[model samples]
Target: MKKFKVLSCAIATTLCLTMAPTAFAGTATKALSVNTDPSDWDRPNAGNFVASYSAGDNYIYTALEGIYWSPAQIDNYEKAYGRYLTLDLKEDGTTHSLNGYSATTTLPDPKFDFEDDQEDESSTTPGYGRNEEVEVVSRGALSDWTRYNYTANFRILNSSANPYLITYASQSIPPLYPGGDYNNVPGVNTTGPALQGEYFNNFKTSNVSSSNSTKAAKTVGILSNKVEVDTHSKSKKAKVSKAYDDITNRKQLEDYKKKHRDLLDKKTSKKDNRNQKVKEEFTVTFNTPVTAKKIKETISKHNLKASVIYARGINNLGERVTIATTELTDESLNKIINSKDYSFKGFIEIEGEGSVADLNNVQNDAEVYAVETADTESTEHDIRPMGLSWKLEELNK
Candidate 1:
């Protein structure tokens, strides 16, 4: 796989094509007429066209100006399309209302949450490191009061997994400065950092487009934005990270229970030991081959609220291993294999408020070879276990 270089600080701050100098030809020879119906603005033979307001008001004014046009024609065009050609002088989150135009709103600062890693920045002792979060944020002054264009300090995000995600929102209002030289805008319009995470080792791209149309003689434009991310992360295979065996027959089930007797009986919770309240792992045999996609769909269909942990070709001497945050009820299991000719044999780990009683409710042919409960002192696990974090790229593909 070819390694794409990370975007330079300059390009990252300015985002993409958005910061390029605005270019427009000479003013229209004939005075441009405004189509109050915005839908006609993009059609062939439209008097004058401005690609997008995102390019800022200067770009819009230049694009509509014509080299040859009488004062009457210019007045007619301005009066007709006054509402559509305007800009909000203020970029703050507050709503600004002015004469001859509806209230306008500029994009607000992007919001983010942060958690302090157990380290002190002001500890006057040697070998103490400053908090990465605070250092990155205070590196330089934010671009503007709105603070839309700033650093992307992602100390809380897992970048190597799937970096470069962007979200945007917008609302429409009547023109704020019709025929006014309002140049500055906020959000994607200003220059600032685009990718500023600790592990920004991936390629991120975005595109923005706009379209206008007339409905009930009212003008309306739809803006569409998209984000694409590509990473060099490798695909993880489905294999039991922690050693576990399949208990097929009654004797093996008994032997397995005896081997793990202390772990099942002990009440002490330890992070490294199997006594932790982590996810329950097991193996299930199906009447027919099932793909990872099918397993995911089944979980969603039944509202299981469970995830497919490890899934690939059969292993453990032909047992399909699976793990989930919640217990898989026999009722859901039966529905999953409905009319598939039951060959469902598996092992289960019951946690608080769960028991073999519900596991016994599987289909008539279903067989549960072994069952074990987690330690009494085990606490619910928040972080996913190793090899369980699925790649979003694979899921999308």
Candidate 2:
């Protein structure tokens, strides 16, 4: 397949002639006047045509200036033929007709008169109120926002294109003119002769006229607005990135759980083997402050190895201290719980190979007790197990 370079305004002009539709000279013989400059139209900057693709609705919106004699002329046109903008779009080497206008059968709000402030501001300008025009907005479905040539029969291209070329020509359409007759009306002879045979051939290639042709062929160009198109792609990328993050986080958590299954199983086992005893770990937290001296004394009395994993101030609980120790016998636990020196205001939680009886006794003796399982999983997994799942469901919803 041939790779045609994306046709832009500059590139399209080089490949084909792009005449400003309004710039075309009107025939002097015609009674009605024509103004092609979009700004000359009734609405502010009406001549400045704009093409934009909306991904949300999968449509292309085009705004342009339409000619009108008076406010009544616009109303009459709508009443007789109904307001519509004819569109011819060239996509993938073929032209498609997609015309659009206000969905309401009746004309909505018609901006007829200019604001008094605007007229006063531009009073010094030539032919101020005499220039009659109105702005027309139309939309058509677009499969993609990328490359496509567009042409509106009654409207000038906002910018320029090569695949679809638009040459400006206007004719006086009497009020209550029938629909689809705008293009068929004869163009009045302007002050200067037409450029067809005088300066360019029918194809606009060179200044040569063939006996069979009477005018220059219409030039074609694509319609595109780069900003909106880029935004569409960025939005798609962001959605994909969010989905990828959710899937990756969920997979990482599942993998981590699979690899650490043995550790969790051994911790939960009830067997009292020697290997289990050395591997056993439990955290004991106290509600009241316990001095290092008191902690050392308790560990010595019970013949248990102890390590202070967290200090009171460093942890969330101001006065609570956490100490890790090996598995303890039921007798030792009972002694520690009933000790007169120590208040035993906190509970003891076992990590591995501790009996349910021991857990019940510890819970019964202290205010609160909870098993602190070892988390070999990633920090993301440790925070919220259902975080990604919730996000996925939200996206689907």
Candidate 3:
């Protein structure tokens, strides 16, 4: 029940400011590389009482500087041509693009704040009327072992000719944090106990898309490729309707009714049993096309008890992502046996051995222990563990 927190420090300004912005062509001149400075961003911690040993980095703070064009150039172009320029991230791989992350471009003008209009009353000022730097902050989590390469492209609106997509700059993002095991050397990367297993199963990042990207063209004066995953499928009601429509006679109708009644009875029985074969419909969107056989193989490789009733890829217009639908039958045993909360009747299993107070990064020799989750949840708050009782000098070698 002992509790502790490891706060991830913000990236030091000294590291960010040192890199010079790369230059591009035309009005969209300046380009910045994806920031991968390893100063303490994206560090993992134990959420609530469950610990995580997973190692991955994120581009949450990765920012791209805007155009350096003068205000007159911007106003004259907009006034004369009646069009706006936009920015887009042209990625070379599926590493970050298919993850459903979005970016926000902040206007450099002081008259309007990024979130809301600075003026109380409305004005005729177009969002991108003034030429300014566009700061695009992208939200994406990079895999520990994957490398991402991409370029910043600007779309220039042309009244007479086809719109131009100019590549301003490009960058290669390397893996900053690869999870590993210690070799008994100081300053060497090592894996901890909590990192060895999956703590929680929140494997989806689709809901994290930015709302600002929707209003970019009108307000922020930029545009980005809309990242979306279509997860639609025919409902059970549609199946029933189709079956009813196919019945042409009284005998067929009676047969369908009896089958429906049997199905309802089976479902009722399954609902009442916790260990029954429960089917869950799930959709997994990958960056590339994958066969149903491949999906089934992956499920079997993971040792999941559920059978893949059906798995098929549904992609549209050859998008960068491939959406696949799957039906899984009862895999509750994995959750029931592995999860700390459900496994031990709500008690948390600490990763390391010894007392619950000995949880630390340097506990290379500590053993595993089971601590009551209620101890930390108590109102007294007196069960907190002291931080890092390990010897500090051992890390200096």
Candidate 4:
């Protein structure tokens, strides 16, 4: 099989921050707008394989920028103060409140795993949630995403604006690469053919070489496993034990057994009622080493509500990214199916498409894809007909 690679840049310095409010004639309505001049930065490719019939001047591409603050990090920071630091924007038309991060503020606390730290290390750190940065880009604004280009890097704060959630979306600008990032090379890794579709399914280690770049490096695949959900329902086990009549009271034990058996039967009945349903698990793996920024990008694209998880050798075969879907919406599922991420990453079924590849803005989604009990995986090395690498382009127009 043919192979190629797209590199996701973690650090870029050439892009400039552009935040302007859109203007409307004779009206006072709340909206956002912008104009920009990006600094020196190279563009990264999001695959554009589809053919556009329009010629020059037929379309104009506009770029939008989206920045993300960790929900866990920021919310926790605010929770410690008995108030949240970031605006909790509600799609239900509720106003949200967001407190900007302060660089010098002390962290409230950090979640601790006693088993991992053995209680010796102080889990809290200074500025744990104060890590705020911007992701900027200029590209063709196409909802169907026929034209676009992008540049990214870990950013320095603009310092002039308070962070805000996207309230408005920009419209069309001309596309950057009309033809998209078509696969330029042909030969793949030695293991390409041998480790086809089922590679991640079996948790096997494999290698594939890039058919495009100037350098040839071995690629590793990362995968997410099927989740094991153990439901805990209302139980009297703790209540009975708390009675405190005696440590070995037979009545307590008897009460527990009766309740436990009833629960078992209840669980069995529920499973039996929904006999045809399957639990879906979609896994996203990186073939290349993913940076903290790209991991956030992957989660946002899928809408799985993911957080970046890192631990050396945890997944057995680590490719730098491991985005596991703990929860998914039906709409997100359909999007996953049609998504470039779904196709490029390879999956038994799509959990969600990797839209940063082809999607301009999720202006309006007609279909979304998700899988149940089926697994999908991504790797840094996987090549597509239009070779591209992406993470944040999904947020902008």
Candidate 5:
């Protein structure tokens, strides 16, 4: 094995390339969660792209600018592709529209239940964290407005696992902004010590972008509206399109989940592994006899989402009935695998039999498909557990 240096923060030229269209859906209503950390993002920022957030307008944008685009950091983003969108809810968890964001890290937990749910918001503090619930949000839904109880204070998220949260920006001189203008913020730290329960009134929202759109608007041609981030803070974003066409096209987010939910579960340490059991979401597709509605209802009884599109010509279809949980243990964990839903004669079992070679193989054909995935490019990131990510550098030349 070889160790690659963690990607340093710097803008690079992003070129449009053609690839094969995936035979799945786009990121719409689901999320792919994994137990990972900063060290993970720190691994390498390759195969990932940087995106910019456009609030109020309900869009997440990425610039066409890169190091290859302009010598200065300000004139980066040029192309505009509103790939993903957000949905608005009417209290019933029903999606009402489309939305987007700046970085993949900006995505909120999909199955958000309560306003006060405890997931760490990577950018700002008091984030929507993942718990034992399936956050059923649609693509481009409002990940904004997380419910907060703590008053008068902004929760500055470190995104680091081991944290020094109690101290204010004062305890440490103002850290370099992620992508904010570096010159004006000052060298000697100005933020101060404060009461434990008291909120920092002027808690700053530092937005960074190596995107030409942001940098250009602020520094050169366009309406520059960007916060200066330290030179140390670099980000990238990439646009992926399946170069080839097929009866089915590939997508990320929603589309990927439908087909790959099984892989999601397979990634789990199942059966006699003895490692701590964390709940994960998996999707299953039923053939011939099962109805998507009936399968969904059955899986829903277990808190899962089922869909028909992924199944296409198949019968009942579903992926995960439950998200992987960190709170589960031994025998209690086996219940899911042993449930009637996953019985040897059932659809999921059949799919398992198709994929796994030795014990799980019960069929020659596999159900479900995965496509349209995205990764956040970073050299070093202070990420929370299960942070959404993928690598575009892996695709970039």
Candidate 6:
């Protein structure tokens, strides 16, 4: 297991002076783009590792320009160690870690033809590369004009070693040695043996650092920048429950019909008509035994069009239970339940129509222990499925 030292350095003054602290406040902005091109920034030496950053209302975005390796190198590196980029974000003196990878299966090959012309080795550039972008949101609201610091690093496994190893930070090699502040030091072989068919046998040590040793691995660092987050504070609100009466009470079916007029008229009119003919069975149970005749009489008293289908034998608790079928609208059923004089318990299992409010009203008026819906196929009688289906059908139609 080999280890390297961590490096730290402030970004060049030229890059920092380009953007003012006040200019980034109260505004969403992106940092300068980073790439292999040397002429893009004042520090042309930082081309190996380029980065761009932006701050939005709630999140900070960071993009790392990918390093190019020959297909052979990628194949061998991926075989020895998995491909991944580690990001270290420093905000208000705290460090956060993030990871990203290539979004695509196959990466483009190196752009320059290194094999055809050995004489132009100095002018040759990476032929293949990748770019990774990640968005990070703070746990709490970010303060406006707050300075944020960040560093990015790329790594691979050193399969050439007997134990197999990976490096985090490069050893002292000058200028690019320390990498940057918050840099990771390469340590012992965390990952075990390499798999068969992996391209590790022909591994290239030059790909690991820029050191003078034959075992040196390639390491690059971007010009670190201080990003100022704009002032945008979110205020906490006191939660108050709105009274049910304060809400505009509209019939569930009417609301559905109004929202899907085009769909009902064009596509589902026939299906909707068929659904209207399907009646559903509802069971009303009492804590004490009540006669079927009494239940039927009660229905008639409330002006509800419901018929007692059957009455069941007394349960262990000696409570009377009756099942009834109804084609009455949900509003009508709610009205009947609200008008009941005696306390009862039960569920309204409607085949096609009903709302949560309707079921709630029934439970409140009848002291129901549970409510079930056949249309929803759920014991809790959720109306979301019906609403979702209606909306999707309307959209598709």
Task: Give the number of the best model, judged by lDDT.
Answer: 2
Give model 3's clash tally: 6
10 residues in a row with least lDDT, candidate 3: 108-117
Question: Could you give me the TM-score of model 3 versus the true structure?
Answer: 0.17
Window of ten residues with lowest summed lDDT in model 4? 109-118
TM-score, candidate 2, is: 0.17
> 1 or 4: which has the higher lDDT?
1
Per-residue alpha-carbon lDDT of candidate 3 for residues 324-378, written as tens digits (9 for 90 to 100) = 0111222212222232211111111111112112211112212211111112223
Q: Which should have the higher lDDT, number 2 or number 6?
A: 2
User: In candidate 1, what are the lDDT values of residues 270-324, reduced to their tens digit?
Assistant: 4455433333322222223344344444334322223221212222334232222
* Most TM-score-accurate candidate: 5
Clashes of 6: 18
What lDDT would candidate 2 get against the real structure?
A: 0.24
Model 5 lDDT per residue over 132-237, tens place? 1111221112212221111011111221212111111001011133211111124432322111110111111223322112211111111112222234434431
Cα-based lDDT at residue 151, candidate 6: 22
Q: How far out, in Å, is residue 242 in model 1?
A: 12
lDDT of 2 by residue, 355-384 (tens): 333322332334322222233343332211
Model 2 regions more than 4 Å off? 1-269, 291-294, 313-368, 371-397
Give the CA lDDT, 0 to 100, for residue 125 in model 2.
40
RMSD of 2: 33.1
Cα TM-score of candidate 1: 0.20
